[model samples]
Target: MTQEYVYDYEPDYDQLMADIETLIQEGNLEGVRNLYETVHSVDIDEVLEDLDDSSLRYFLFMLEFEDISDLLENAEEDLQIRMMELYSTKELIEIFTFMANADVADLLGLLSTRRRKELLNYMKKSDSNILKMILSFDEESAGGVMTTEFISLKQSLSVREALLKIKDIAPETEIIESIFITDRQHRLQGIVDLREILVAPGYTPLSDLIEDMPFFIYAEDDQEEAANIIFKYDLKYLPVVNQKMAILGVITSDDIIEVMEQEHSEDILAMSGVSKDEEYDSTFASSVRSRLPWLLVNLVTAFMASAVVSLFEGTISQVVALAAAMPIVTGMGGNAGNQALSIVLTSIARGDMDLEDDWKLIVKEIVLGLFNGAVVGLFAGIILYMKYGNIILGLIIFASMIINMIIAGIVGFLLPLLFDHIDVDPAISSPIFLTTTTDIFGFFVFLGLASIVLPYLV
Candidate 1:
């Protein structure tokens, strides 16, 4: 009987680090290579990221050139730049050759102009030209992320000829799920999946296998727009065409996934009043710089809310309980407003809601606010009455709570729409504005009502 040895696929970061340390101390290059072979590329990349600078440099230097190239490609942008700095020009050029042109261009774009020029001078003319073309597009555009290494065949070719051509190019191309069908002028005509070609008769022309018109995006289109189109169509590879409708490159699903992740991260960070570039491992100065501006803006809004409270200071002096209860109104309003803000922002991001639905959405939120306020106000009023033994105070708080909640819903729904209209990112600026409105209105309503009913309470 043969015994099967099962390897643990789950990543154990500390154990892996210790093992690597032992291997390095013993100078076991073969053992390190064996360890690399056992781990998945992404897991290896994670392990490399966890290492200290010295350990990272040593491991990177000891690895095969191909392994280093793979690691660079999978690494974060900052780490890729660091690894690029570590390698000599000749070694960098060799590593670049193994990487996709899009990734090579991305790494080179991060380098200083002098360094980029020196590296570009060492690369082969053809590879340099490809990198230059990719660098020409904005980093957030489809052309920047798209790869030139896609299988394209003339529409005139027979299935057998197309298959042979694909076979020849398959070794060089990264994406073979779909073969782009182009005209003599290299204009995109249609696309045929490789499966269709495999099942079709060899005598069938490639054009016949194209079930529908080619769905492609322009090179200049925003990467997010491209990602949305790919998501909408459920495509694995989306062709990028030039202004003349000629095939330029292809954006794969993997690229779209990366874009989606980045956009999500940016949106979440923006909502929290932090810069998109500030990561968990960012320098203290960088993090402070990113967050301080927003905090300052919030401070101004806080003062504004404070000014509203000052208007009813006389009423508060008569009844100190009003001061104690003030936070409840403002805090509840803030929470309610945030809920509406989240819904509206998510709908806008997904393209489910637009400015045209502003009135409809605002009215719906206000109605929801009214219902929620009534429920919350009922319990709050009962609590206030029990605590103060004053029915008048209870009724005053109940009315104030209801009015503040209504204000919360209205302000929350409108702020994002208004920000969108002014071309400001709703995610970044909406929370600042929404919280201010809720705080100001919550304080104003609660205190104004108390002032009006002060005689009855005393």
Candidate 2:
């Protein structure tokens, strides 16, 4: 019988961090290195992010070039800059060789142009040229996120020859799961999986192994488009081509995964009225700077809602009950409007909602609002009637609730579409605008109705 060793897959993160900190403080380099080797690079990056600046620098110094490169590739932009600053030009050059070209380009894009040029001077001419080419493309394009290190073979090459070529360059290539088969002019012909080549006859031409009508994206296309394609097709690797269909580079699934995560984070932050660049651990001044503008906008909208309330001060004074019930109307309406806004914004982000069918979505939301409002308002009306013994007051509250909810639905559904049409991000601005609309209208309608029924209540 063979003895087996089982590892604790769910090791306590806090305990591991404590151990790492002790090792760092004691200057136990070998122990730290051994401990780090047991954890994944992503976990190491997370732990490094939490470490104090001095400890982080010391730990980074102990990492080999390959380990440092992996950390830099996985770390956030600010951390990447900090690590780069700690490294000398020669060290940076050595680390860059181990990093993927796409990662190198992204890291360089964050540096000052002068600094980028200086760093480039230390890299090989070929590597520097690839980074420069990637930098030439917009940061949000397929070309920008793609790695130039991919295996490509002429369609006419036999399977054995292609395998030999792949074997020669596999060590340098970032993606070997799928090989691009191109024409003599380097035009993308199709894609063939490495598994297919392994199983095919040695004499079979590479073209025979090509999948029919393989999916690819243009290098200049939006990075989101590439991400969407990868998601839709469940792809392992996607080829990037130019207008002439010439293969420029390849975007592995890992690149698209990163893009998706970034996009989701940005959308979530924008929806909360925070700047996408604002991090929780950012400097206090930066946090204030990032948030103050949105707060100011909300303040203005709050005053507008107050202005509507001021118009009905007399009604509230005469019937104190109106003031008691006022918040329910506006609160429910605001909640309803936000529901619509959330759905529409998500649909827009996922490219699900058609612009031309805007009216249909609006109508659907309106109907939904009316149905929900009727159910909610009925209970509210019944409660008011039982509490105040006034049928007219109950009727007024019911009508106001329904009307405000309808307003909420309309405003919420249309604002995002309007913002998108004007080339603004709907997620960032929609909630602010929708809240303002619901508040102003919710107060106006509820108070205006209360005033009309003031004689009966008083």
- Provide TM-scores for the models: 0.91, 0.90
- lDDT by residue for model 2 (399-423), tens: 8788889889988888888898887
lDDT of 1 by residue, 1-458 (tens): 22222238876877777777777676677777777777766777777677778777887777899988888888887777778888899989998778888888999999999999898888899888888889899999999899999898999999999989998989888888888888899999988889999999999998887756557889998897888878877888788999999998999888899998888888899999999999899999999999999999999999999999998889999999999988998899999988988888876765566786668767788788888988898889899999999888888778877888888888888888878778789999999988898889888888888888899877
Give Cα-based local distance difference scores for all models.
0.85, 0.85
Q: Candidate 1 at 236: error in angstroms?
A: 2.7
Regions of model 2 farther than 4 Å from truth:
1-18, 50-57
Please list all clashing residue pairs in model 1, or write none if there are none: none
- Name the candidate that leads on TM-score: 1
